[model samples]
Target: MTGKIRGISILALLSALAAPPALAQSAAPSTAQPAAPQAADASQLEEIIVTAQRRQQNLQDVPLAVSSLGASDLQDRQIRDTIDLIQHIPNLIGNNNVGLGSSNTYYIRGIGNTESIATQDVPVGTYVDDVYISRQNANNFGLFDVERIEVLRGPQGTLFGRNTTGGAINVIMKKPSATAGGYLEAGAGRFGETDIRASMDAPLSDKVLTKVSMYRNRSDGYVRQVNTGDKLNGSDNYGVRGAVRLLPTDRVTIDLAGDYVDENEANLINRVDPATGDRIATIGITQGALAKYFTGTKANNEVGNSTKSWSLSSNAAWELDDLTLNSITGYRQTTQRYFIDSNPAAPNPIATGVSPILNYSLHQQWSQEFKANGQALDNRLNYTVGFYYLHENNWTDLGTGVGTASGFTVSGDRTIKNTLDSYAHYAQGDYK
Candidate 1:
C-alpha cells in the first residue's frame, strides 16, 4: 500500500567544470603489463548513454542535437515537472497556461501549440517508454522515479512522424529490477509547503520483479484574497506508479506498468497592466484600495480545479542472432473539471445572478507499434523499420449560466467531440 500528499515548491541549480590536461611522461619501452591507470577524479566526465534513436547508444554518437538528464542529475537539479526544464534546456519555453491546474504549453524554436482543442496538433511531441502522448493537456507529467529524460531538437519527422516538426521530449521511467531495495524522502519549504515520496522494489520469483512508488505534496498559494484571507494558486496533489518485469526465457523479456495522478488545487488569474505596472481589478473591485497589487485579490474566491489521469502500457522484446523484435502498446485517459471568474467589470457575481465560466474535458488515446532493429552487410549497416497505429477520442464542454452558492446551474453550453485514427509505415537505414 502507498499514500501521497501534494503541492510543494522546487529549486534547481546547474554547474560546469574545466579540467587541465595531464602532463606526458617519458618511459622506457618494455614488454611488461602497463601499470593500472590512476583513479578518475571529478575532472573526468562520465560516459552518457541515450536511446534517442530508438536504440541505446552513446550520447556523443547519436548524430543529433539532444540533451539528457539522469535520475541523479534530476535530483541534484531539483527538477519537479516539465516546466522546470525550461531553465536547463536550450531553445525551450514552457508554462502552465492560465486556468488549467496540470497542463503545459511548450515552445521549441518558436513552434508550439497554445490551444487545448482536440483537433489541434502539438508541434512538439511528448512520449513515455516509446508511447506517444496525443494531447497537450495530458503531457505535463510530474517527474518522479524517472530513469532519464531526453530532449531531441530539430525536426524528427522521419523517425518520430507527425508532431515532430519542432522536436520531442521522451521520458523514461525506472523499471523493476531483481534487486530488492527502495527509499523514502521528505522535505519542507516556505509557504507552508511539505512533501513525501517513497518507493519499494520486491522480487516475486526468480524471473518476476515488481516496483511501486508514491508521492504527495501540499503548499499555500502565492496569491491571497484581501477580504477572505484565502490562498489562491496553491497545489494539492498525489500520485502512484507500479511496474512489473517478467523474464520468461533467456531471449524474451516483458514489462508492464501503470500510473495514476489526482490534483485538487486553487486557480487564480493575476493580470498586470503593462503601461502602469499595476494590478488590474476584476468584477468592479476597487482599482488598488483593497490590498497591494502584486499578490492581493478582492474578487469572489470560489474558483478551483479537479484533475485525474491514468495510463497503462506494455513492452516486449525478443532477441535473435542478428536482429531484435519489439512491440509497444499503451492506453491513457484524463478528465479535468475547472471554473473561472468571468465577470470582468459588472455587478459582482454575488449581486448579479451570473455564474462562473465552467470548463470540462475528457480525453482517451491508445497506440500500437511494432518494429525490428538489425544489422546487415558484415555489421557495416544498421536499420530500423516499423508500423504504427493510433486511436483517439476527446470531449470538451464550456458553459455559463445562473450562479448558486454551491455550484453553477449551467443553462448554456458548447460541447465538442472528436475521434481520430492514423496509420503509418516507416523505415530507416544507416551504412558505414
Candidate 2:
C-alpha cells in the first residue's frame, strides 16, 4: 500500500477508539417521578438552545426539525459515539460493515451515500465546534468534554458550504470554564473491557484559562479465529486534548484547542459455510489433501487494523455595542489500515481457498469560517451573515493476494485524488 493510503487507514482505526457515547443532559427530568402541579412553574421547565442557523435561538422557536442532546441525556443513554447516537435521533440510521474496518455509512431521512471510496464525500456534513469535517472517514473522532450535539435534519444549503443535501451534525465541545475543577472516571465490564477518562480545568491567570483531558479504552475480541486460535474484533485507543482561553477584554475572547488520538486492533471476523442448510460436523478435509482444490494454498485469513489522528481548532469572538463577530478555524489529519478476506469458501466454492484483501487510506483536512450577527431595526429583528472555506486531500491503495497450492501470489495498486473549495454569504432575521 502507498504511504498516503496507509496513513488514512490508520486514522480510520484510531477514530473507532475515540467514538464517545451520545449523552444528552436535557432528555430527562432531574427527578425520577413527575412533579406536583404547583412545582410546574416556568422555572421548572428545561430550556434548549441551538445554533442551527449560525445564531443562538430557542430550539422550539426554530422552524426546522432538529434533535438536541445535552450532556445529561447522553450520559443516561450510555452513548459513546456517532453510531450509538444515531439510535436516539429519529429518522437517522448508521451501521458498520463487519471486516470493513471503520467504513460506516449514515442515512438521514432515508438519504445517504453507502460507497466507501475516499474520493466520494458523504451527503451529510459533520461539524465539531462549528468546524466543518470534509471527509467521512474523519467522522470517528471521539466526543470529549462535549457540551452538546445538534443533529439538524433536512437540507442546509444556505449556511453550510458543501455536502448538506441530507443534513448536518454539530458537535460542541465544552469550553474552558473559569472555575477550577476536574473529574476522573474508570469502568470495567464484561469481555475483558476497561475504560479510563480524566479531565481538568484551571485558571492560568486573571484573564486566561487552560484545560486538559485524556482517555484510554481496551477490550478483548468477541470472535475466535480458528486458524491461529486468536480472537478477532478487539480494540485499544488513547487520546488527549488541550485548550487555552484568552479574555483580553470583557467584550473580546479567544480560545485555542488541539487534540490527538491513536488506536490499534484486530477487526472483523469470517467463517466458512458448508452451503447446505443443515449443519455439518467439520467437512472431512485435510490441509494438504485440499491443496489441489484450493487455487490459493492459504487455509485461513485474518483481519488486522490500526489508526491515528490529530486535530487543532480555534474559536474567537468580539462583541460591540450592537453586534458580535465570530471566527472558527480547524485542521485535522488521520490514517487507517486493514486486511480482509476477499473471497470466502462458501456454498458456491467450498473447495476453493480464501483470498485476502489488503487496503489502506489517508486523509487531511482544514477549514475556516467567519460570521457577524447583530440586532437590527431597534432590536426588533436579529440578523446573521457569514463566510466559509474548506480544503481536503486523500489517498488509497487496494490489492488482493490469491494463494495457490503452488504458493503463487500477485498484487496491484490504485490511487485517487480530490479537492473542494467554496465561499458564501448568508443573512437571517427573526422577530421576537
Candidate 3:
C-alpha cells in the first residue's frame, strides 16, 4: 500500500510538470506580488501569512479564530513548549502530571483531556511542520529554530481530522535557504541555569540547500530532597535537526528533514502529612533507599521524569497553471519513563519496614500522516483534502515496594494498543 501511494505521488508530480504553460503563467501572478509590498502598520498589523487551510493566505482574510506568534515573541516570552505557550495564548492552559511524563494535558477554551493514560485521547491537536504529534511526551521536543507558531481556535474537524474538538497548534520551523547564515544564543539565570541554541543554513549546490540546528538546556533543582539531601528536580535536554531542500527546477521543490531529542531529569516532589494535610518531617530516610526503592521523594514527588523522541518529515510541492500541489508526509516516535512517590510518612507509619508508596510508568508511541492540498478556479476557490493514519502502543506498570520500614509491597500493570485510520475531503471558497 505504501509503495502504491509513493508511485501515485510520483506520477502526480510528473503530470503537474506536463501541465500546459498557459496555466503556469496564470498562477504566476500571485507570487509576482510579494507580501512585503503591501503592509499596514508594521507593528500593529504585520503582514502575517499562514497555511491554515493548507495554502498561504493573509491572516485577516481567514475567518477562523487564530493567533500567530513569530520567533521574536517566542524568545521574548521564554516560550519553550506547548505548556509554556498556553498562558501566553488566550484560552489555553496545560497541566503536567505529578509523575507521568506521558500525560501532560492541554485545555483550550476549557475543553481538554484530564486522564494521564497513554491510551487516552486529547481534544487539542499539536502539529510540527504539518505532522501530527499525538503523544504528550513528545511535547517537550524544544522549540528552537522555529519560524512561527499558529494556534487555530474552535473545532477544526473538517481539515485537521479527529481529536481536534478544541483546536490545533501548528509549529513551523525555519526552512533551509539558498543563502548561508545562522545565529547562536546562550543565556543563564538562577538555580544553576544554562541554555544554548545554534542554527546554520548553507547551500550545498544550485539544487540542494541544507540547514542544521541544535539546542541544550540544563538547570539545578530549586527544591532539595530532604531524605537524600540532594537536588530533587532539574532537567537535561538536547536535540538536533537537519534538513535538505532539493529544487531541481523553478516549478518543483522537495524538502526532507529529521530531528532527535533526549531529555532527562530528577522527578518532581510533593510533601504532605495525611494527618494534618501539611508538611511532613524527613529525619532518617537515607539516599540509597530513596533512589532504589522510592520513585520520588517528598521535595519533588511525581515531578521527576524523562523522555526521548525523534521524527522525520518530507514536503514536496509542484506549481501548475491555475493551482499549486503539495504533499506532506511525516512520522514521529517517543518514549517516556518516570517514577513518583505518592505517600510519605514519618517513622515509616504506612509500612513496618518499607517506604510509603511508589509509582513507575513507561509509554511509547509512533504516528504518521500524509496530506495533499492546493487551490483551484483562478485561485478563488482554495481547498485542502487528505487522508491520515495513526497507530499507537502503550505499556504502563505501577508498583510499590519495601522501604526501610516494613510489609509495604503493591504492584499493578496495564497495557493498551490502539490503531486509527481515517480519510477526509474538504473544500472552501472565497468571494474576494
- Which candidate ranks first by lDDT, i.e. highest? 1
Q: How do the residues 169-190 of candidate 1 rate in per-residue lDDT, one tens digit apiece?
A: 9999999879899999999998
TM-score leader: 1
lDDT of 2 by residue, 1-432 (tens): 699999999999877756543233435456666645664567665779988888888888789989999878887887666667778999888775334444456788887887566677787788888888776554655566778899888988777755888888888878888999999988998779898888999988879999998888888766554434455566777789999999999999999999988866544535443453322211122234322332332322224566677899998999999999999999988876665545544333224444555556678888888899899788998888888777777776655555533453655444556665656667677787
The lDDT of each candidate is 0.76, 0.70, 0.68
* Superposed Cα deviation of residue 216, candidate 3 (Å): 0.4
Error of 3 at 62 (Å): 1.1
- Report the alpha-carbon TM-score of model 1 versus the true structure: 0.80
Q: Ten consecutive residues with minimal summed lDDT in candidate 3?
A: 294-303
As a TM-score, model 2 comes out at: 0.78
What is the Cα-based lDDT of residue 19 in candidate 1?
19
